[model samples]
Target: MNSHPLFSLVAGLLSTLLMVSCAGSKSYPPLATVPEVNVQRYAGHWYEQFRLPNSFQKDGASAEAQYTLLPDQSLRVVNTETRADGRQKTATGRATAVSGSSNARLRVKFEGLASLAPAAEEGNYWILQLAPDYSAALVGTPDRNYLWLLSRQANLPDSTRQKYADEARRLGFNTTRLLYRPR
Candidate 1:
């Protein structure tokens, strides 16, 4: 009755579970105290300028995310990316607003199979900031490890970039770690 195989199996299972838990716990700090965001105006296409490296986005990739309101109180999320090799990847997901707010914060899950789960961990997304005119946005995690700068248009205005950076800094984000990707 050798115990080595059983011990190895248990260890592997624990490792896998730990990895999944870590991936699921990704979170960002609430947006720096700011005026309430007009979600209707904020809904639309946004081009990604910079983002913290995630398994979903490639370096030097050009990406866009479209948000649309749903009749059932959910958001239609469509994310498309053009990779460096000219390959396109698209992911569709549903985002539901977290309860008790104006629906500014949401959790988005790309895996459609888990769509029915009451609260799935895979689609944990939050909107960190938005420009008054809906021209730009800053998204990130509570731990400040992940951040994304997005613009309504393909190109972001210099003034808007500076303003977003300043706001990010005030929020205790490490602006230096931001990777400004070229579209």
Candidate 2:
């Protein structure tokens, strides 16, 4: 039995593991001039144009997320989706804007159901980009794991979509990970 072959196999395995680990690591570019996003102007109904798939939301379906300012400096998030079976599902969560910096950063927790334990780390949700007219928004997490393209109405114009995609790319988000939901 030659020891050289065994050593080469071990080296290859280690290199593969290292590469995989590095590829899986998460990093996000610094916020690009945190915009002065008015929470009041942002509050209302937004339709999901694209999103990273979550177990809660199904594919090829229309969904709406309603945001309302709560009394305690937090947001009331109500997400409703029309499923393929023609049934509707809704999830409610609370989002608290991180203090300072014009409320561009927020923490969202969906552990409202009594049966589930609260999340250990409040999910970092950031509004990366927003149309000056408040017609569209690009949102993502600090770790760059979750990103969503949302519009004020059920459909967004092609120009708006392209603009958001370019902005997301500029912000170093993985545009390939963006999953467009059917209108």
Candidate 3:
């Protein structure tokens, strides 16, 4: 079957990402998240400073996430990104904090084909590092495959960027693979 070039590229990247994550799992020690996260302070707009490459976010720039605390305590997540085609894509999702995790872990589900599968309901969002004033955060998965460095602003200073990279490296993620978006 002859698939479109873009589709093939996306499929290949997705496959490679999953295979690498599984193959690299044994090399890292158990992933550890912060002891607690005050969702109240953590809520609001967060700019994506950098992230480990993933198929779902290909050709996207200026990615950002907005987390709103719902009355029911579940969070309404809105993610916006400018695409390579000069279009903006915004996805809204729901996130529920894992019980007994002190809000450090979240199960995020967006409205898409993936949500139809039961396995996609599992928790994937882990808060690894958060600044005292909630100015910055390092979030990743337990497998150390997916990682994102988030900030309250789009441009992080050189020193702060290094600090975030150092933290991700220390947490077992391969910092060299980080992909930064357009400023």
Per-model TM against the reference: 0.72, 0.76, 0.82
- Per TM-score, the best of the predicted structures is 3
Name the lDDT value of residue 54 in candidate 2.
61
**Stretches of model 2 off by over 4 angstroms after superposition:** 1-28, 111-123
Best by lDDT: 3
Ranking by TM-score: 3, 2, 1
Model 1 lDDT tens row, 96-126: 7666545555667666654443332322455
Report, for all candidates in order, the number of backbone clashes: 6, 0, 0
Off by over 4 Å in 1: 1-35, 112-123
Error of 1 at 82 (Å): 0.9
- lDDT ranking, high to low: 3, 2, 1
Model 3, stretches more than 4 Å misplaced?
Answer: 1-26, 117-122
Query: TM-score of predicted model 2?
Result: 0.76
Clashing pairs in 1: 27-142, 28-141, 28-142, 29-141, 29-142, 108-123
lDDT of 3 at 95: 84
Residue-wise lDDT of candidate 3 within 1-183, one digit each (tens)? 685888667767876887776884547777788899988888899999899998778745669899999987888999988777778888888889888888988988888875642222236899999999899999998777799989998888878988989988987899898887676
Clashes of 2: 0
